[model samples]
Target: MTTSDILRAALVGRLTENGTLTDAAWAKAATAVPRELFAGSYFVPIEGSTPTGYRTVHPADPGWLEGVYTDQTLITQLDGRTSPEDAGEQSVTGAPSSSSTLPSLVLDMWQRLGADAGHRVLEVGTGTGYSTALGAHRLGDRNITSIEYDPLVAARAASALRAAGYAPRLLTGDGLDGDPEGGPFDRLIATCSVRYLPMAWLRQVEPGGRILVTLSGWSYANALALLDVTGPGEATGRFLPGYTSFMIARPHDRPPRPVLALLPGEERASRIDPAKLDTWTGSWVAQLAAPSAERMGSGGNQILSDVATGSQARTVPDAAGGWTVVQRGPLRLWDRVETAIEAWQGAGEPQQDAFGITVSAAGQRVWLGSADGPGWDLPV
Candidate 1:
């Protein structure tokens, strides 16, 4: 067997052992597909670099093939422009715009999607086309339509898919808009996270179809949501178990912000531990409360700055007791967060699995325990 085959087998074995690659069809697809072909080149983050820096890795580099086959998300692009080829041997720093998501997460999501052999699938954010290839292999290339927001990323993915001997429908445009001509797909899966469930996806998917996506926000906390389209412009589903995150959809990402100048407005004692905002589900609750606020810092010294209204909330440990929060601007960022967190705590401090989302023409709201339970309206 070739070295590639050995690495691929090991990956499949690891995934199967961990119960992620359960279906025989998905296992076959994983075994057959060469991850390295799509990877071509990727970025390795430099350790302890301010603003985070990445160094490129090429095919000629030792352990490149092994790294490709490893179950890890590999950064492919930065700042929506720079790629490994562009950076060459230099260490560059920028927010990651594209990546090859870890194999285990990809396959696990595909399984959770509940796609069958003959189902037509719409895939968003075809970063490396690796996930698209897997889906095409399991569901047939003719049944898969993958869209990429970046033209260059799409072109590279198309080339790689061709090289891998698979030809799925590839489109260069916004994945959020989806494919108008290729409507009514049985399954719609996004590789990126959206701030709110897009109405277009609800309209495009057939009734009873499934849309599996990660719900994220300015706070950066994410949870996987699997919704079943019940009717036109409506769907309801629960947050899946376990933590899943993806790069925010480019269009849904927060707008550019000016330098923050902390201003004083109101001060109060924090109702809940400000450090709760640092936990996974707590941060998610905080996000639900202040959807437009960008969160920074951590633990006792948590900072929240609102993007739309210029509202800001900063928390620090109180010298006398627990925590104190200072707020300014129109929105009481900390008040909302504290209220939401208290509600979540009142609901017994459940994990993400206890949360579910409902979408309608009125708006979408993510609820805890049940649809009627304490819920937060998505900033739709």
Candidate 2:
């Protein structure tokens, strides 16, 4: 077998062992797409290091192809601007803007989406064209429309797709808006996370079609939801089990806030441990409790600041055997979070699967247990 073939087989073997590729057509497509064509030189972030501090790996580098075949996400862009090719061997410092998502998650989501040969799919966030190629291969290239927001990234993905001999309609625009001219599609799949379901997606996708996306918020807590468009401007769905997250949609990202200034505030013994803010379930509940707050710090050092009102809460160890929380501004950030934590706990700490969503022209609302159960209006 050729090196690419062997690499592809090994990758598939790994994915199969982990239960990522259940559908045969998708597995074949995964083996067919040359991930290296899309990734090229990529960045590997140093763990617990500066966000932008990464080592660049080129095809010529020893074991680079092996790295490509590894079941891991590869960083492609930093700070929304720089690619590894732009920075070369240097370790730059910034947030990762784009990536080739881990293959297992990619295939898992695609499998759950259930788009088939007859279905025309609208795919959002065509980051590396890897997922796009899989979609194009499984369905027909003519049956797929992939939208990418970053012009440079879109152009690169286009080049990669052309090299791979597949051509899907690639649009350089916000995926949230979808493709107006090309839609009313059969399925809408988003690779990025949004705070709430977009009404545009509901309108663009035909009634009874599926919309798969990650529901995320300012806190970056996220869950994958599969919504079925029930009518014009309406859809309802439930969060699937398992942990899933994507980078927050660019437009839905919180606005830049002032650098943290730890100011003194109303101090009291904390009713709940600040450490809860760092756990997966706790973070999800805390985000629901204070939907507008951006969380920072970790464990007992947790800090939460309201993005809109400038209210802040900082936790410190109390000499009297518990934690002390200091609060400032009009909004009591900790109080809201504590209430949410209590609610989630009272409900037996249900998993994300117990949550569901309803979307309409009015807005989207996420609820726990049932449509008539405890819920919150997603900030649209």
Candidate 3:
């Protein structure tokens, strides 16, 4: 086997072992699509970095093939503003804006989506178009419509799709709105995460269809949701197991803010462990409780800053065994976070899979355990 052949097999093998790729058809399509063609030059995030600095890898880079073949997301753009090619050889700092999502997740979501022949699909966040190519390979190019928020990214993906001998109806627009003219689709999958379930997607997909997405927040906490469309403007589904997240859709991203100041606040004893903020599920619950706050710091020195009202919550070691939390401004960030943490603990510290969402003409709610259980309203 050639290098691409061997590396491709190795990557596929890993996903198969991990149960990320299950079907024979998806496996075949993944192997056939040249990932390098879609990711001609991608970015590798620098370890222990800010703004997600990237190391560019071109087709000429000795490790380019290996990097492309690895079953991991490759950062493609930063701050939705700069590309690896634009930064030359030096590393630069900016948030990751786009990526060729991890091969495992791309295939896993596809496997769960169950799109097949005769199925018309709508894909949001085309990115590098690798995932779209996989869908095109399975359902045929004519049956799929992929939308990208960035025209430049869409154009690059479109060119690569054609070079690889496949073409879906690639368009440039706000993917959060779905394809205004393309759906009533059998399946809708978003490669990017959203703050809430977009009603537009629910309305456009046919009843009994599936919508695979991630519910993300300003705190960067995210959970994957798979909804079965029950009727017009409605759907109900549960959060799938395991950890997976994508960048927030551009339209749902938090607005610009002034530099954060971690000054003093009203000091008092904390009711919960400060380390809970580092716990995977605890952080998720905290996000659901205070949906508008951005968390910072770590361990005993954690910080929560409200994005809208500029409220602040800072934690430190107390004279006693517990933590001391300080709060400032209108909202009580730590109090909300503490309540959520207690709720989760009271519910037996359930995993992400225990969560589910119900979307209707009224609104969407993410609940723990059941539709009537502890829940939060998702901004629709």
Candidate 4:
């Protein structure tokens, strides 16, 4: 075996030992595939003499080839297209469209799925085909159906999978709808992040089946949940501690709106207690609780209010790096919130640790905490 092969083996071994891969099937899959073949020119390499930690696409170099197969990430596409040719030869922007997810994260999510050979799996987001290849290795190609939103990416991934000797049924379409033709799957795994669980996936999968997805809202964390499909259109599961991020897959090809433009004007120049503003509110909390809020800008100049209720206020920085808050109308809410945050911080700068969503027999609750104790709560 080559040095790259040895490194691949060690990476797979680490994943297996870390409880991410319980069955030997996944390990075998990881070992059998040459990750470099599916990777793009730019890949993160192992640390060493070739400036290994940097991203490079020098195909001729031995280090580059080795970097391709290592258990690190590779930038396959940027901004919905193949990376610029010049970028392949130089250090450039690192916006990633698809990649073989970090090994540990992949293994953890795959294990969470608990797929057996008999299982029929529908995988959303066929990026580098690495994870799809792993699924095929475990459940066989005939039983795997993978979807990719980008037609070009879907085609490239299909070709790569075939070249690697694994051919699952690949589809170029929105994964939100799923492949209706391959219905009643035993397991549905989404490698992409989603704002809300698609109802179509729930409708297509068999009752008591599992759906593992990276819930897109608040906590900014992934949840590996088992969906019973108990009712006609409802499924539920508690959140699990898994961290992963994927491109947002949508029906259209348009890019996301810039964050700065989305900020409300009232929030442009407002005073805020930095401590209160930094509380462990769930991801969606900001959007829901403070719809027109903006994180304080530099040198505090302007403050924003909803105008209708003025319940929330936003402050921006002034010429110097100082914050200001302005409040008006019915909602003198910002002042109270600022005070609460300052009070909490005065006690101590509490480090908020685990924040997660809970869905079970009782109901749904979102909780936040640090090493100390619970800090806040929100209902879903």
C-alpha-based local distance difference test score of model 3: 0.88
Please state the error at residue 175 of candidate 3 in Å.
0.5
Superior candidate under TM-score, 1 versus 2: 1
Better of 1 and 3 by TM-score: 1
Which one wins by lDDT: 1 or 4? 1
Instruction: Give lDDT per model, in order.
Output: 0.94, 0.88, 0.88, 0.61
lDDT of 1 at 326: 95
> With candidate 1 superimposed using the best TM-score fit, by how many Å does residue 244's alpha carbon deviate from the native?
0.9
| Cα lDDT of model 1 by residue, 85-130, tens digit | 9999999999999999999999999999999978999999999999
- What digit string (tens of lDDT, one per residue) describes model 3 on residues 234-253? 99999998888889998888
Best TM-score among the predictions, by candidate number: 1
Q: How accurate is candidate 1 locally (lDDT)?
A: 0.94
Model 2 C-alpha lDDT per residue in residues 104-183, reported as the tens digit of each score: 99899889988988899999999999999989989989999999999999999999999998999999999999889998
TM-score leaderboard ranking? 1, 2, 3, 4
Instruction: Flag clash pairs in model 2.
Output: 52-94
In model 3, how large is the Cα lDDT of residue 246? 86
Once fitted onto the true fold, the runs of candidate 1 whose alpha carbons sit more than 4 angstroms away are none
Stretches of candidate 3 exceeding 4 Å from the true structure: 48-52, 263-265
Q: Report residue 128 deviation for candidate 1 (angstroms).
A: 0.7
What would the TM-scores of all predictions be? 0.98, 0.96, 0.96, 0.72
Score candidate 4 by TM-score against the native: 0.72
